[model samples]
Target chain A: MLSEFDLIKQYFARPAAARAQADARIGLGIGDDCALLNPSPGMQMAISSDMLVSGRHFFPDADPTMLGHKCLAVNLSDLAAMGAKPLAFTLALSLPEAKAEWLQPFSAGLLALADQHNCTLIGGDTTKGPLNICITIFGEIPPGQALRRDAAQVGDDIWVSGTLGDARLALAGYWKEHPELLRMDEAQHRQAALRMHRPTPRIELGIALRGIAHAALDISDGLMGDLGHILERSGVGACLDVDALPAGPILGTQIQDIRRRYTLAGGDDYEICFTAPAAKRAEVLAAGAASNTAVTRIGSIEAGSAVRLVDAGGQPVELQLQSFDHFTSA
Target chain B: MLSEFDLIKQYFARPAAARAQADARIGLGIGDDCALLNPSPGMQMAISSDMLVSGRHFFPDADPTMLGHKCLAVNLSDLAAMGAKPLAFTLALSLPEAKAEWLQPFSAGLLALADQHNCTLIGGDTTKGPLNICITIFGEIPPGQALRRDAAQVGDDIWVSGTLGDARLALAGYWKEHPELLRMDEAQHRQAALRMHRPTPRIELGIALRGIAHAALDISDGLMGDLGHILERSGVGACLDVDALPAGPILGTQIQDIRRRYTLAGGDDYEICFTAPAAKRAEVLAAGAASNTAVTRIGSIEAGSAVRLVDAGGQPVELQLQSFDHFTSA
Candidate 1:
């Protein structure tokens, strides 16, 4: 029975100081025309927005809690890519109807991750429409210190934080040619589904790699496709070792072709793929250790173009793997 | 042939120094995980997000250019209400399909208004989905100088900028009794329709009234409803003179009832309504002149509870007026 404004006030409007932990960046939060953020001196504000529409981004009846987590997590992954400390986020949520049962768990899942990352919900719009969640996050990074794709240099070792392919494996039902894979053991399926639904943003690893990694990006699309972006922006190529990729444990007895394709080209990884000088291998590993995230050396940037995948024998492997293009693919 | 990325690059990504002048706030733009904003010292970043769904917010075949303009204008009006200077914005666009014909004019109209306000489109996500445009705008305001709704005192005079009701009149087809009103001459209809489409945010007036206006807000909903917000926040009441409101010229021959409802309670005005002390009337008028806007005194703040509307005879006029509630209204 709550109006839109009432729904917002009761659910989304958190007290500025409640979970912010003395961070007075938010001058005014909800109930105003705009939320006010007081930036720290000498700090640049990093911002990114992502939209997730039902049927396209998620199933219409996906778990509300995980849906909430994934929406904020993807945006946090963007901030992590920039090595920006999470500050606050605004949610412009469009819902088919205001149902408390759905909103309760959704907000719980969202605010849980927000609190873990020291981020606050500042302000946003909640309207009636086909379900769509668009979140814009603001973070802080030192001026001139942001890791950018254009800064990747030749000879830089490419590293990925955390493992890849788990989410895609969880979605093997949509992978075609893998109908039996959905019959995996309950525990393994749960693990893979968790990875698909609740991706960690790798915030600490990103912060630790600020000066060590020259260029970085979060893999949302497939590894081949996302890494291709780095190559295109940096005007360089990569020689990736298919066998060296840290893949998910769910691919226990899968064939090399399936493993290679999933590991080298699967999407929804939410892992940070970064380029760094080979000399900083020890430091990169140390950063990985400090952040408690596994850092795997998967490839090296080359002067030429084309992201060439190689087998364990160092021979070229040919595979047609394209990133998820929402428009063209759908 | 264009993917979401291509559509963004060809249209929304403006050159680094296009119209940002000497401001170095945007350190990075499109193609990055996040855009970086370096706020000026001693300034607060003001942010607001607005979403316009295709069917709910606009006609499916509405002019893409005007839709773009309105999308950004509403957010700019939020900044204007906060007495903030425009900084940058992020656009999260969900499209049913990527057509250059639609995107070209859409981006052009969006960017033109952004350029006019010195706001740069920094970074956002574009995806294929149901048509929805969500824009989150950032602006800068000095500490403690932002016009707040809770700052109005009991004796402050209420003022509104420019005229109202033209927009609601343009859509008078929804007004039930207004089939004949739409038969006005082409120029009149054009003027009214223009008001309905392209709302000019009173940014300058907001900045100029920083120290003068005790409280302020942009009227997106009807006046009576929006003024109730200020009264509620300021813990006061209002006595609005219905006849003193600045109504559009197109409503010259309209009946008193229609004029009262449209002028006093119509939505989509986008005009600034502010409260100032009676002694600061000259200063308020001066601020209005400096901003090149007409300021009309339509009401006063009082130490009581209801928003009472009085007619020309100084008699109380009883009418129920409510603002547009996204959920309840639709």
Candidate 2:
């Protein structure tokens, strides 16, 4: 029965873990009309925003803690894509009503991940409405060093961080026609849901790959669609080895074709996909090792305008893998 | 019909006026996953967020153009309250569907205000959901010079920018016993609605008062409620001359007591309230004149713990004015 402001103060106003750093740049945080951040003299602020809505973005009864993690994680993913180091974030949340049970764990999950990345919650707004969470994250990067989609080189090798399709596997309950496979054991269920709900933003790997990767973007709306953005921006295409694409163990039990399509087209992986010189292969692996994230070279950027998949014999695969479009996808 | 991404490209991806400034700091704008801002050295970044839901924050059938203006206006008001110069803003918009008829004018209104303030449209997300608009604005102020709520000192003169009560008076249709006043003529109706809808954030005035005002905040919820925030933060009280409170011409027709109540308790007034030393009264007036915003001295900060209103005869007025609480108010 708390008011909106009261709810914010109780749940969301906890001091950020990053606030204790000696070089912390937060000048003023929550309780003021605006939060103040003091960016270092030579650093550029990287900013991004994401909105998640109930029913559209998640099930109405989805786990509140996981939802909270996903909300901030998606925004942090953008900063990761930019090769920017996390700083602070603001949340503008709208809910049908305020409830203590839902808010306490939600803030816990959110702040826990925020603490992991040293990102601080600076300022935001809370209101009464249909449930929606919008987060804007800020990060810092040196000038001219951010990984950009337009910087992809035609000859660069394309790589993806982490295994793909586990999140979609978790969402099999929604799209899978065979209901029996949808019934997962507790371990598998938790693992798959963790992929979908508590995505790691690859902040460390992004920072490590700063100068090594030529161009980069996070995989949110599937590898195929998101890579298409790099292709269009850099005026190049790519060729992927169908047999070489990495998939989580959960997808191994699925049919080969289904596994291929899901790994390529299913969204919400929150993994970084980048292109780097073939010579930097060792460095890319080193960067992955430093961040403790597995990096797989899946393809190579090419001269044409279409992304094509091929077998080991270089025969073209005729599968049409459609990406998850927010409006057009089921 | 447009997809979410398509809608963003078509409407919200326009370039910013600040991009033309010699000190243009935007490194990457709309098309990127994250926008980059290069903050000048020794400047602190001021950040604030606001969310406006269709029926909760405005009339369901409200003019889309005005709604757009108000959404960004409220956030700008926060930056103004901190005496920060706006740099950029990201709009995380959720709409039931993408309809060009609605988006065209909304973007026009939003961008027009953004252009006037030299604030750039950076990067944000567009999604399908119930209509919600959340904006996070970034502004810059000199380090340690922001107007903070907790900085009010005892015996400082309190001044307000612009007139009050018009916005709440426009809401008379909701609270008034007689409905005839709601049937105002076209010009009158538009004029009154303008006060409620297109509130002018006193950005210039705030910047002008930077060194003069000890503390400042915008009047969003009633004057009594917002002043109470300053008092609570600063550990002081205030004394206001009830007869000296400013009201719009619309409030002139109301009963004296009703006018006093609405001016004191009614919210949505975006005017600023700040405290300054009595010796700086001339400078405060000059700052107001420089910004072309009217200034009125209505009260003074005191050493106690209550905000008391007094009449011309110096007799205290015993009255309780509740501010608009979103959860508790209708």
Candidate 3:
């Protein structure tokens, strides 16, 4: 029964004491027409936005807390890919109705991740409609130091942080699209579902790899599709080792064909993929270790404009592995 | 049907020449994990976000071009209220489907206004879902010069730019809700609809009033409700002269009671309401004149925490005028 203003004030607006602590770089927080941010003098602001719709992006009855976490986490992943430190974010939410039962856990999940990264929620808008959450995040990075897709070198080694394909494997189980292909125990299913729901933005790994990596991006729409961005932008190609891709524990137990498909073409992985000079392999490993994340070399950049997929024997492995396209895919 | 990436590249992505001209402060734009913004050395970045849903914010079959324009215009109004110069914006759109027919004019309308304000569309996300458009805008202003809502002082004269109530009048006509109280000819109805659909953000007026105005905010919800934000933030009250309000040309011809109701409580008015010292009246008028916007004094900030409404003769008027609340309003 709360009005929009009352709902915003009750749920989203931070108290003065908390606001002051959370808003070191924020000149103004909520309750203003526009929030003001004072970026550090020599730093460039890195910005990205992501929108999640209820039925399209997640189940209509998905856990509100995880939904909130995933929304901000995706945007934070972009900042992580750019090697930018999180600063602040603005959320615009459209909901069918305002209910405390949903909002309380949602905000709690969102703010928890925000607090973990020292990111402030400066301002946002809330309205009544079909449930949609859009977040635009801001981060700071030293000028000329951001990891860019165009900077990939042809001889660089392609690396991925953490594991991939578990989220997609979890999604396969949930949707039952390939029931015969994907089989998982209850414990494995729960673990994979957690990956799909609660993605950790590799902020520390990105920051640590700042000058070590040449180009980087977060993998949301599978490894092949997302790494293609780096290849396309850098005017280069890559020779990916299908057998070398680091798969999640659960996915690693799957058949080789299923494992390759899920790891190479999975969506919602939220893991960073980067290219580093072969000379810096040790440095890259050190950076990953420093950030407490596992890094695996999956491929090597090539000269021609064709992504060549190869198995351990170096024979070309051909497969129709199209990445997830929101409109074209089911 | 275009894939998500192709849709973005075809419609929303700017050509290199256009991008070069638009992105002066942008280091990295579209095709990156995150866009990089190089803020001016001494300026603070002002940020605001707005979301519009299909049925809640507009008619389901509304003109796509105008809808695009209005979506960006509302966010621009926030920058105008803060006396910040527009720099860039990120759009996150959720659409039921990607049709070139809808996207063509929509991007044109959006980019046209952005070009007018020299605001670049640096980065965004597009997905399939119920129609929703969320834009987060960035602007820049010199440190300590932003027009904040909490800066209003007692005895300051409150002034408004442009006119009010035509948008709400158009809504009434379209909805036929109170047909007895509202009447309009075809031309008048078109004019009112234009007011509702194509609001011009007072960016110039706000920039000109940077040092002249004490507190400022754009009137979106209604004068009574939005101005209440300034009063509540500043810990002051106001004495409003209802007769002195500048109603839209069409609303000006309405009955006294109708004009009072609509002018005082109409939503979707993007004009700015600001407070300034009585001694700066000449400077305020010069600022308005320089911006080519009409400015009228409508009230005076008072010491007490109550907003009093009165007529030209200083006789108090009693009216139950509540501002539009999205969740609670019809």
Candidate 4:
């Protein structure tokens, strides 16, 4: 078992690369009873929380380190939706029991992401349960400048950052407990599984999009499903272009068979999906470039109040929207 | 099972009583998907998170509403310890199954306390897991005004707010699953049961203690145990007046049988254990009185290496230092 001191040092006390991009006034990161960060001037703090349960969010045997990473990633995604710059986070970890070796690697993974994102571990709680991890993240955005799901405007272009479906394909092909194709080199499988375990939250893209994007949300529950949130709240609709979507190579190869199902249904890709006005397209692209972030235009807003799929020829296509719904039939 | 909408509306949407003395930045309370708050000028936000799980923090059959209240209350205690004014909080609730009846009352209880304390609900995650509720709260304090556990000085006067041991007594007498008691109306038993279920956090008093209390922490664990944390971190010991110690009526009744075990081992009862100087006693009392909060002098910080509980005759009592340790066997 890992000692409490060592567990913190290994997992949580570390930093991520983008941390250098964090705003000044962050006094300490991880290893303290609480983390301290000085709020940026003229900014209001935004906070969001998430919980991942073993056997629900992941398989029981998923690596603990990756579990740690994914936990922080989900909360970061929430901050992204608010167009808030990541600052710090607190974790509430409940395990069936404390095991030192498990904690060491888990903390390492969690700290690694925190270091990469420049997010400090501010405070946490530990207890006994069926291995549940809840993370609450803190970020800041200029007041009234926050990107919201209700702000999508008519005549806006819909966009998503990064390729989708890789996580879903990995889950179906690589991480399955019983694989039909005993495939993808074990190391490659580990990497694919790592993606499933630790998704990169688009904090930079989110912050950059604040003044550019009209409405934004992090794509945790597949593009179609999460984008539905914007349409619902904004009282608008979208015409998603199937051909314009940034697809994982695996999805492309399986497109003839899987029919882009994973891209439409897979939920773990922690990317940001947003809408920008036609007039601000250049500014949006410029902000993306300035932040060294990659973003792709995928769709357009519609005056009609229904989401539809458009084929490459701009014809509506029939497709299954198998998005993640906690209450939907399993 | 509780529907998501009703659960949110009934439990989480309620607001606290008007605090004209409180800050005016809580622009919106708990009705919307995300709460909006105005940031106070020159203040930095402090955050903390804690999770309570059934079979870990309480019995599985514990009143779900009280369980919900306790989870949010504890996180509020963290903010109190920092001398921050309550602003907003996010709740991540995981349940094995969805039950609308359970959710409505549970959210009602949470909203009741939130309304009284003026903390808004911004955003949170709700999913399926073994019954656990994780609350992450945010508050703001003036720059460098947040009190912490590590700031105790040797000359400070040790003080505790409210009485203790009622929680221990409630757990022992009211929490036990007695079929005969369950069959009876048992109003007194039920109220006692509430203390064991929902422990109120001291937010108002904590804010008042901002510049007055030198160092402070919420006594979630028993006085001896939590104070030991201050002593260990501050590198000093204490001399507690056993007779002056406030145990309320329950502990007084139980100390005769269990020999003061109730006072020494009770958990929950989110009260503040703090240290100030002799010169500030009247100020501290006035602060509590102004807030309808009670505080008592229980001990004094001393130049010593260990804690010594002195009796009314000024003789040292050889009592074993016992308190709750979550990791250790009960």
Candidate 5:
């Protein structure tokens, strides 16, 4: 069996020259008790952590490459939500055993996404246990310019980036939980599964919306639940047009009821749900155009503290769509 | 069963005012997409991550409070080794279930240590899975002042703080693998177990040795194995005075052979093994005194790349002791 040190050295440790070219903010990369980072002057470090367990977060025999991509992708999504530039990250991994076959693709997937965003792997710990991948990501952003959840204002336009519900559609298809309801072709299944396996963090769009959007967050635990966090923290409410939400291409072909449920409460989307002044609609569209991402205005911030769901004609729509809760709602 | 949101709000999330008083570097704490941190100007951030699994790192039925303390203690030990001041930490916890009976004391132990070090728990993630605790800690240090592993120079005096081998002694007693070779009373058992469960981080002593010690690291994986890291990185050797090693008070009563094996190769000591200039021996002692930790000179950096152990009369001592390796050792 390979020792822990050899495992890290073989798979994760980057060459010195490659690491130096990855990011200059890294004062010390690895092979130390702690990795040192120097945040740029006038910038605040944005930090977030996420843990992906074997059975709960992914399949027991899930593709190692996709698993690696998803783990870092989730964390980087948090940084994107903060409108921060990715600088570095640390990975704490617990594996049952050290296998070169598994680690080779895993590191490739992880480092590929890391390199795409110019994020360096600083330092971390590895131990023997049931498989768990925990990542703490660090990014830099100018102080007071962060797109905070509490910054959403009354009468702001609610916008979402890209499509939603494809990841959840793939999950539902995989589990066969709604076999009677979900009917997908082979290509649709592959495309939806890809959405779940490889999420694109909206880094460029977040950076583009820095001063344009009022507040924003990544939609991971469904739009309704995640947007509720922004509302709860901002002490506001929203009036959402249920029929106007942008659904994934495959999901758009589903039945109207299924489209409504999946688009409203589907988790793992990784899209940005943000709010901006109604007057900045053109600017918001330009920002989305600049980032080359689709932006759709689906709702508006309201005065009261209750989220009202309305149909296309503005009539209230009553539905019970539960969000994904790790503990209570399986 | 509580939802994930409810569990976080009930157990881990601290009151706003309490969090504000804990750390000023935290610009935005929990309830956001990511926490924001402002490093003091000219101070570099030292980051480290540690993961602790239930059965592998601790007993399945281990006391949750002590388990919590040990998990954070090990990560803080890394910051201490780098001579950095603790600022904030993020935790990602995967649990089988959320039970207040287990969480109450666990949070108590974890938060107590954080408060003692004036460190804040900025943010974290919680989910359902096999129990695992991962913490990523952030600290601050001046540029070029960190006690690095590659800074040891030839003829520098090597020192060890406090004592060693008590944690391993407790493990040996519990496993009963060497019952014929070890004996201990109940009081001695409790003392040894405390060392295993709640090892001090030596943070103050590390900060005090800022400019005095050339190279330093925490003694988590035994003195020999950890010291070997410094030797490999610095391209130097060490001549250790084996008989002069400071054994734990309880281990001091053991026989010579048992003492040698436990003191030299025992893991989980959490003491600081540092190398300082021979001319600064008096200053080193004063540094330890000011930090109120016992420091003992036990070796010297040599020209070659091997660790040589000798007795009081300079006679070589031959012994075969293996350091703890997570993958290769049982």
Candidate 6:
């Protein structure tokens, strides 16, 4: 079995990716207890952290490789929500026992995703426990350009990228329970698992939307509950058009129902949810195009104080709204 | 009892400490789900992480408050070993169940230490599991002045600070077993426990020794074992004067007779061990004095292949050193 040190050197350590961006002054990365990063003058850096516990966030017996990818991906999502460009990250791994096979594939998956996103695994601690991985990501953004959660304004249009409910369906063990999900062969199952394993961090899209987004947040808490943060913080109300939502094709009829609230209140979509003025709609779409990311207008902001969703019939759709609270258990 | 949100607001949020020499730009400190840092131009930021798990790093019933303190302290120790100044930190907290009383004091202790050191608890994740606390710390230094374990050279002087072996002894509950060990004072028992609880991170002392020290590391796994890390990495050997080691006063004549061996191999001191040239000995002492942090010379770097302990009689100390391994239990 390869030791932790060997695992890191084989997988996590990589040469400079694209020369550390001119603005990013990373003098040293990988091979040390810590990575060093230098940002340009007057630019503010953002840091965020998330912990994924086995059995709590993923299946206890889930693939270790996927666990590693998901850990870094979730942390990158937090940085994206703040319009921060990825720089580096740290991991703290807790496991019940050390298994060489698990560690090898896990490190490979983590390092691959990290390289793709231009994030370096700077430092971490490994200890024995009930399999918990905590990741803290560091990123940089120009001063004053960060899109805050409290900046949403009345009359702003809400937008989300990509289709929702796919990760949710995948989490339901759909691919594991039904062999039809394997229609595209082993590669297809792997791809679907990849989406569930390593969702892309929309950092480029976020950086492009810096000035365009009035209020922005990651779609980790479903749409309604997360959008509620914008409404509550901005002291405004929202009118979510159920029909305009970008639910995946799996939810054919319920797409416009507004009551089946997985996409609305189910968590872990990791998509960016932003609000902008109707006049800047074209600009927002252009920004997404420039970043090669998608954008779909799903709702509009209003002057009232509550977030209300309207079904296809233009009638208020009153659905029980909640979020995936870390402290509150199922 | 306050909810998680309220607890975070009441304790973790604080103003960033502005430093002229520190390169880590912590703009937004301890609010939202992440902290914001803006690095100074031409300066690089160093980061490190450490995780402490129940029944692994500490006793399962360890005080929650002290656990928080030690978690952050160990990570800061890494920054200190690298000659970096800590700017901010993120904590990933996992618990078997939600207990307001436990979390409140735990957060308070963590925030107290962070505020004292000018580092803020920026962001963290809280979940349900066997208790584990992982802290990731951000520190800053000049682009290339970081004292690293791989930089030690032969013919340099070795130094350590404070004393060692209290934590290891306390681990066996030996101090509690013998009333005479603590001068029979009940408070002494608590003091020993406190040492195991809140370890002081040697940041100031480390930063002060910046230019003088060639290589440095924290004495986490004992003087001999941790110092061996530097020698092994630097491809040098070390000869320690076992009689010159610094040991706590708790041990009696019997333990003191072999204090050199235990101090050489005991772990969890959190003190720093560094190498410097004998020519700059006065300057190093003056620097430690200026900061009011004691520095004691212990041994010397030698042109050899491995670490060795020499007694007063010029004979090698015969003992098998045992250090804690994060991956496996003995």
Error of 4 at B247 (Å): 1.4
- Candidate 5 falls in which docking quality class? high
- Tell me the interface RMSD of every candidate, in Å: 0.9, 1.0, 0.7, 2.8, 0.8, 2.0
Task: Find the 10 residues in a row with the least total lDDT in model 5 chain A.
Answer: A14-23
User: Whose TM-score is higher: candidate 1's or candidate 6's?
Assistant: 1
Candidate 6, overall lDDT? 0.74
Which of the two candidates, 4 or 5, achieves a greater lDDT against the reference?
Answer: 5
| Residue-wise C-alpha lDDT for candidate 5, range A226-302, written one tens digit per residue | 99999998999999999999999889888888898889999999999999999999999999999899999999999
Error of 1 at A245 (Å): 0.8
Error of 3 at B103 (Å): 0.8
Q: What DockQ does candidate 2 have relative to the true complex?
A: 0.80
Local accuracy of candidate 1 as per-residue lDDT tens digits, B109-146: 88889889988888899988899999999998989989
Model 1 residue B141 distance off true place after TM-score fit, in angstroms? 1.0
Model 2: per-residue Cα lDDT over A40-129, one tens digit each: 889999999999999977888888898888999999999989999999999999888788889988898898888888888988988889
Top DockQ prediction, candidate number: 3
TM-score of predicted structure 4? 0.89
What is the lDDT for B252 in model 1?
A: 51
* Per-residue alpha-carbon lDDT of candidate 5 for residues B67-177, written as tens digits (9 for 90 to 100): 888888998999999999999999899999988888888888888888788888889899999999999999999999999999999999999999999888888888875
User: What are the per-model DockQ values?
Assistant: 0.82, 0.80, 0.91, 0.45, 0.89, 0.60
Q: Which candidate do you rate higher for lDDT, 3 or 5?
A: 3
Give per-residue CA lDDT, model 6, range A98-155, as digits (tens). 7777877888778778778877666677766788889988887888877777788888
Tens digits of per-residue lDDT for model 6, B115-217: 7778766677777777888888888888779988888888999999777766665654542554344342445545555666788888888889889999998
lDDT per prediction? 0.87, 0.86, 0.92, 0.72, 0.90, 0.74
For model 1, what TM-score does chain A reach? 0.96
Stretches of candidate 3 off by over 4 Å are A15-17, A21-23, B15-17, B21-23
Superposed on all Cα atoms, model 3 deviates from the true structure by an RMSD in Å of 1.3
Inter-residue clash pairs, candidate 6: A45-B37, A95-A129, B25-B38
TM-score of candidate 2 chain A against the true chain A: 0.95
The better-scoring model by TM-score among 4 and 5 is 5
